[model samples]
Target: MDWEVHQNPERLVKTFPFANFREALAFAHRVGELAEAKGHHPRLTVEWGRVTVEWWTHSAGGITEKDREMARLTDLLLG
Candidate 1:
């Protein structure tokens, strides 16, 4: 997971694989809940058995430490 940190747009990309669409949506929902709890939301895309999450701090105009935190949280949720 190189996940090269960038300066502009403020986002990091991560992809998760599920056995099926239902599992993917379930994981996405969990991420949404976590985002609400942290007050930091991420953009998500669900396709078939894969879900892609992008985290960015809009106010900072770039990726922040919070983004990585949320990314880890997301991984935990999926796990």
Candidate 2:
């Protein structure tokens, strides 16, 4: 997993579409579980039919491997 692969200007940003808010929230919950398990959390934004996830090591002021790993797992959940 490489955080550099995600090209958002703010950094560590990934977005996905869902059928509805319910699905988006469900996916967010799954992300929450993973974050808790690994002790790494992300900033999440849920809209009508989409979710935007941002992950970065705040203390370090940049993205890290953990963010990429979580992004992959989040993609898996969406799949």
Candidate 3:
């Protein structure tokens, strides 16, 4: 719910900050695991102090309710 949802291409995105690269990478791995479990993958950009996640349904040719839910799950992952 704290994520930024975008239109046009239709996607949900969010950036999570961390203390260091290791922390960011660990979060990214958790996101990866979430994606695998739900079969809904996001574009993950991992950086030293941050990780960005963008969710959209490629099969749907845009964003869908599934993507929104996946975005919600991503939040849960962080929690």
Candidate 4:
């Protein structure tokens, strides 16, 4: 749970480090698949060696239990 909590629009954020751009992009694709399966989406920023994921419920206007669950699943992706 290394996620950062942000207010104003409330969300859970985490940045995962990778060895290279290819690895980072692959991770982002995996996350997209997960989001599609769960019907929940997150903001993903894929960079050269890092991918930042932000999870929030847009309709709810903040973080929710689903967001927390998604964050956990996202962590498991790295493991």
In order of appearance, the predictions have TM-scores of 0.87, 0.81, 0.90, 0.96
* Candidate-wise lDDT, in order: 0.85, 0.77, 0.89, 0.97
TM-score of 1: 0.87
lDDT (Cα, tens digit) per residue for candidate 4, span 1-79 = 7899998799999999999999999999999999999999999999999999999999999999999999999999988
Clashes of 3: 0
Q: Give the candidate number with the greatest lDDT.
A: 4
For model 1, how does the per-residue alpha-carbon lDDT over 20-54 read when each residue is reduced to its tens digit? 99999999999999999999998899988999889
Q: RMSD of model 3, in Å?
A: 1.3
Tell me the lDDT of candidate 1: 0.85
Best by TM-score: 4
Give the C-alpha miss distance for residue 57 in model 1, angstroms.
0.5
Against the correct fold, how does model 2 do in TM-score? 0.81
Which model is ahead, 2 or 4, in terms of lDDT? 4
| lDDT, candidate 3, 1-79, per-residue tens | 6778777677888999999999999999999999999888899999999999999988787888998898888888777
Q: List the lowest-lDDT window of 10 residues for candidate 1.
A: 1-10
The superposed Cα distance between candidate 4 and the true structure at residue 7, in angstroms, equals 2.2
Q: What lDDT score is found at residue 43 in candidate 4?
A: 96
| Pick by TM-score: 2 or 4, better one | 4
